[model samples]
Target: MKTIQRIKNVILLLAIITLTISCNSDDNGGTIIDPEPTTISKYVVGFQAFPVGQASPAEYILDLPSLESLTTGEISVEGQGIPLRGWRFFHSAGNTVFTAGYSDDDKCIAYQLDENGALTEKANFAFQSTLDNYAALDDDTLLAVELTYGGLSDKRFHFINAKTGLLEKIVEHPIDIDMGSGTVEDPGSIPWVTGMILRDNKLFVSYHKWLADGSYITPDVDRAYVAIFQYPEMELEKIIEDDRTSPIGVNGHSTGIEKTENGDIYSFSTSALSAGFTAASKPSGILRINNGATEFDTNYFFNVEEATNGGKLFWMDYVGNGKAIARIIVDDNIGAWGVFKEQGEFFKLVVIDLINKEIKDVSGIPIHANRYTSPMFVEDGKVYLSARTGPAIGNNGENADLGETHVYIVDTETATATKGAKVLGLALKGVFKISN
Candidate 1:
């Protein structure tokens, strides 16, 4: 009996040890199990969509691999209301994804993807009355510039610490882009900031001396300038100007300046008349701000229009190894606005060798009328082009419903494009990629 009791005690001790070990393994109120690995998303495509004719475009996201249904319009079909507010293609800097709606109830929103590929909304910033153009400063910060029409006193800069949910506002700065000396803006012209680029703690603001009254005018057509300021402190540094280009970029968009692998910052200015009538003397060209330099390099001007023998620069984004994919206005009659209002008949896609100063029109990419094209993305010496085409309209608008868009994967060496997934209903505004 004593031996049996000793055996029973040993068994009880072993049972308790087993229970404690099991409990330790599942300490966080759940069982521990290995999860199947998820594929890291290769690409995230953003679409600007509308349900019907002339509706304000909404935002949509396409998750790769399981792309059975690619359009966000299908979400509306699933009893989900598509709540879109002037949402532009999202901008990604580091780990966060961000987008904004101009003068809307929700001024901005940002999201973060978890390790398992689940996305969570990190912030939704609502403005009182001012609308802003936001640019990503980093994964944890965003810079919002409130334009003048937001009440003149609305010339405020709001910096949001996206990680900490903290915001700081700066209201005063020395801003005078017009021909005048003081902050008093030129008559019939307002300052339209195209975008902001941050470099080594300095902020470069690209802007146009816009012609108001619903018209376009370049007051001084020969030269364009960008305002440099001390970042975080928000003090004026100096205005850098170059006569090689009309404006530092196209109108109201963020593709103006690109930084290459060599850390050289290149700016493209379109000399199109619709972009405010650039001087005939100055061709649409490329200007460089050498690495770490606050001023333009006077000796480095690659005349893009001259390179194409009369083509005007439209849009440009840098690829690796001193090359860029560019859109040039190949014809003069189609003009700038006609690319939007009439049909996209004037633009041509080409490869630019920044080092060699050569421009070659990309072949195998169809040229059809499109109102807008997606902001191109570069990866591994290739560019992603998204352009939507529709039926041509006559002197009177007719048969306009024949619209379609596709994503093209291009090989820079061959200058040929192969089409990928077709998107329905909306145009692809931008493509943001995620690596596994």
Candidate 2:
């Protein structure tokens, strides 16, 4: 019996030793396991930087804690941030941010936050032509369009899965309109797609008739045209025209058309010479299409140029509550082609009440030049956009002193603006909020 008790005591001591080892293994360097890192969400700012001696500008995307925090200091992309292949346009849907290479590279890359709270490339896709226009059909899908210069070839539309960064489908449609008597090299007048939106199972595409000879000559400037198509099916329904205003939208700018919160679609027409129009036959104005309707409302027309006393609408985006934030060129003598060439500061930020057809200038923002600006980021009745204080490009095609570029925060209700973060680059291409 004593021998049996001795054996039992030895077993109990062994069990205690095992328990002590298991509990102190981490301190003793025995296969320690680390906790998983937590992922974070951040706001991203795309900056176009021109190094002092470089011939071309570099594109950089940097993640920030908040846009408002950039108000005091200058933000630069010098040893930090992700550099893109070339100059690109930025758009965000859901948690992913899409960047499309404009000229040299015909690729689109989607970026999202990683576990380290850094912006990382999520997916990459390529296209034959530059994506001129894009719209988010839903949180998961993005619709992009590519149109050739002369509109002689078939226009291609891409439906992409925004979440997966995959091209789901491609729809092609031929240009059936009479493009005048001209060869493929120089079609006298071709349809130039400016903006597109999807609403109520239908898609509306706004365009202008422009010359193909690189003259920026808008041939038919007295009519507003919108092509209506069946959404999801991608079938053409009809092309509606309104003679009340010039062609809807401008080249390289997507603010030519937008949809409001109440389901009403509004089209902006800038028949001003500064807005890539070689001629101004009709005054700049706004046209509307009622909810669930494909045709322009016959009784509704907002003569914006007349209302603002000759202020031409340069760009606009809808804010909620029947209002829109717009950039208006107040100078009547801004020479033709100067706006696109970045000649002077003629753009003034304003808030327009679409319901009352009234305009109020936003205080605190100086007259600025908008050679190339991204779509405004609108959230909770506030709009955020990059407002550069100087010209983006000099007259000699060299990098000019692009004064300070700041993210301007505009209050839709008060019609006031407060300068936000200062960019240490040539310009701030876009600002976005993305998640990992």
TM-score of candidate 2 versus the correct structure, residues matched by position: 0.86
Residue 390, model 1: lDDT of: 57
Please, what are the lDDT tens digits per residue for candidate 1 over residues 54-146? 545566654444332332223121233133466454556555555656554445666555567765566667655443455667776767665
Q: Record all residue pairs in model 1 with backbone atoms less than 3 Å apart, i.e. clashing.
A: none
Clashes of 2: 1
Candidate 2 achieves a global lDDT of: 0.79
lDDT of 2 at 191: 70
Clashing pairs in 2: 70-421
Clashes of each: 0, 1
TM-score of each: 0.78, 0.86
lDDT of 1 at 154: 19
Candidate 1 segments whose C-alpha is farther than 4 A from its true place:
1-42, 66-83, 86-89, 103-106, 114-116, 128-134, 149-155, 162-172, 177-189, 211-216, 275-281, 341-343, 369-375, 391-397, 434-436
288 Cα displacement, candidate 2 (Å): 0.6
Best by TM-score: 2
